[model samples]
Target: MAIVKLSATERRRASAFFTCLILALCAWIAITLSNSYDYQVKEVLVFKNSPQKRAFHPLQSDTVTATVKGNGWQMLFSKMNEQNRIIKVDLSKLDSEAYVVVSTQLNAINAEKAVDNEIIAIAPDTLYFDFTNRSDRKVPVQLVKSVNYQQQFTQSGNIVIKPAYVRIIGPSNVIDKIKFWRTDQLTLKNINEDVNTEVNLQAPDEGNVSIYPKTVQVSIPVDEFTEKTIELPVKLVGNVDFYNVKVFPQKVKVTFTTSLNRYADIDEEFFEAQADLNLWRAYGYSSLPVKVTRLPDYCKIVNIEPHNIDFIVKK
Candidate 1:
């Protein structure tokens, strides 16, 4: 193929067409860069540089409307870059409750995307905060756990927690309301043996509040149990001297379940079966209900054999 050379008149026309296109693009950009525009960024983050010794709690809104004035291009760029709208204030200068007047400083805000544009104004130019003395408190820790035991298994003794108390420090307003710190929810299913584990504690929602020793050791003792039955002599209760009371079948089978660890420690003497003497006098009933008034804490009563026993009273 051969190239087609254009005439002088044709070349001039082509050049003028290209020149006009370039001129139009440049004019558009120039206009966009020179025209001023207003932009409002909602929820502009107001970071606080608080003093290490004093904790400053912002009782009011921490966000502000950053209304900035700049060229159309800069405004549009800032709108797209949400991070550039954030500004930080120093709270170390505060002595007590005060209103801090904050002015937008281009150089200090968003140093990475520093722009030459000017800040028209910032809404709620003043920020208010309450500064209180900071101190630490020791609060007891509570475990939030659910244990579903397998058949014939029961928990024995108390649940032990290492470092039962934690240190919490924050503003007095918040710390005073805190009675105890709680551990994260822990659930064990079909557990048949002792459980020893470390669990994390829930963190305080307040930004200024902090807790030391975020985790604690939890130990739960579990043991297998079996039902045991023993015959016990019944004793009369209530005004026994008024009437001579005697109960037929003086012995009652006490059916109970006990953890294996404490099975040997339990004895028939530890149990006290009793029959109410008042019932014999009130309704003059021939039989009275037998109850095991006292038993070991580790033992769970399954049934009181021969629930009712015959009784005879003689005046």
Candidate 2:
């Protein structure tokens, strides 16, 4: 076949014709994408205004498919977004009924979502929940923390929590299972002074439990630490029979580092120095190993004199 080459004028006309065709194709795509269309999207359900009289548990998973009506532009963007939409369902009517009709709450739900993306309907449009006996229990609060203290500064005494126990009200089964609630982690770095603040407890999980006074006041005593020494008489332990046990140097010097606030509060009575007699009887040891069985809180032992003591047993 012979090749057909166009003249300069013919080439220009062909180029213009192809450009118009391309522009027309682009216009069609723009018009189509700008039109509104109905689409489906997934939404996570969150129940609010729970009935006060009944303790309830959802019968189905919180996710539901929603029919949405919006422009193609928004429809395209929704697919690209990795996050699923969330719809808050009002459960106030559960006081009189066991099921919640989500359609009735559409006006309120729409207010929570994007204005342009109108939700048409939802699959499994009605939500059902199981009811149980509502009960309230008072549970202790445990503090979770990560602390770094300044040099020579540390906690002086026991931490005080105002309202140490929080009242939890929910299903009896859930309340009975919870013995204690933990507060959110409190982080402190380079702390030199006392800490007094309100820390929130971990939020109730799954909406099955509700906590009252969600936050508690935490007071931590902080003070500069200093070394102190005290002399205390050593006592004998593990000698069941009344045997006369004499330990040499009847007393030992207890040197420790304590916070300044607790310096005057702590004394020899706060600690018990004991020599285990079992060391001699069971192992035939020449000396008895001395141990400090009890020490006050927030006090660090620096050194205990006569870690091993020479003793005589008179039976």
Best candidate, TM-score-wise? 2
RMSD of 1: 8.9
Q: Mind giving the per-residue lDDT tens digits that candidate 2 earns over 261-313?
A: 67888899899999988878889999977778889778888998978889988
lDDT of each: 0.79, 0.89
Candidate 1, residues 73-92, lDDT tens digits: the string is 88667757766655666565
Model 1 clash pairs are: none
CA lDDT, candidate 2, residue 158: 93
| TM-score of structure candidate 1 | 0.54
Which portions of model 2 miss their true places by more than 4 Å? 1-30, 79-84, 278-286
